[model samples]
Target: MATPTTSTGASNKLLLAIIAIFLPPLAVALKEGLTGTFWLNLVLTLIFFIPGIIHALLVVL
Candidate 1:
């Protein structure tokens, strides 16, 4: 059987946003795998506030 997935939710979202703001790569690495999401998260963080990147990463993760 396939393994079930888990989510951290909005609270995690806020956490991730804070992480993304100050931690950057750590937040992205937590939410997204090293492949695609990494670059995307980096770009989003660069383009928008850490919150935006955090929101995206939270949903994607």
Candidate 2:
């Protein structure tokens, strides 16, 4: 029998989303790394919206 594994892509996306909510820059850096321009921008945008806060809290905690 083989152990089942979850998809990291989905998980990472969720994690990034969470991180972006609280700390946009930090979350972007963690999720996307140096090449995560989209994530950073989204995080910044999140600052103006509710999703951003959710992302930040989830990522930080």
Candidate 3:
């Protein structure tokens, strides 16, 4: 019961992390929506891929 839920949450985080690797803004948007964080991530992504990935991983995990 609780274990299943924990596994599901962990899998979801893994998926989000993968998505963040390719599309940081989309991953951030899925997790945090169109808030300041999302905008920041978008800007970071446009500025540089590495920074966006780091920010997205930090926010998602």
Name the runs in model 2 displaced over 4 angstroms: 1-6, 32-61
* Model 1 per-residue lDDT tens digits across residues 1-61: 4333324365677787676667676677777768676776667766876555565556444
Answer with 2 or 3, whichever has the higher TM-score: 3
Measured with C-alpha atoms, the lDDT of residue 44 in candidate 1 is 71
Work out candidate 1's RMSD over C-alphas: 6.3
lDDT of 2 by residue, 1-61 (tens): 3333446665767776666655676675575566656474465565675665554545444
Best prediction by lDDT: 3
Clashing pairs in 3: none
Model 3's TM-score against the true structure: 0.93
Report the lDDT tens digits of candidate 3 across residue range 1-61: 5798899999999999999999999999999999999999999999989999999999999
> Candidate 3, residue 25: CA error in Å?
0.4
Alpha carbon deviation, residue 57, candidate 2 (Å):
14
Clashing pairs in 2: 17-55, 18-55, 18-56, 19-55, 21-52, 21-56, 22-56
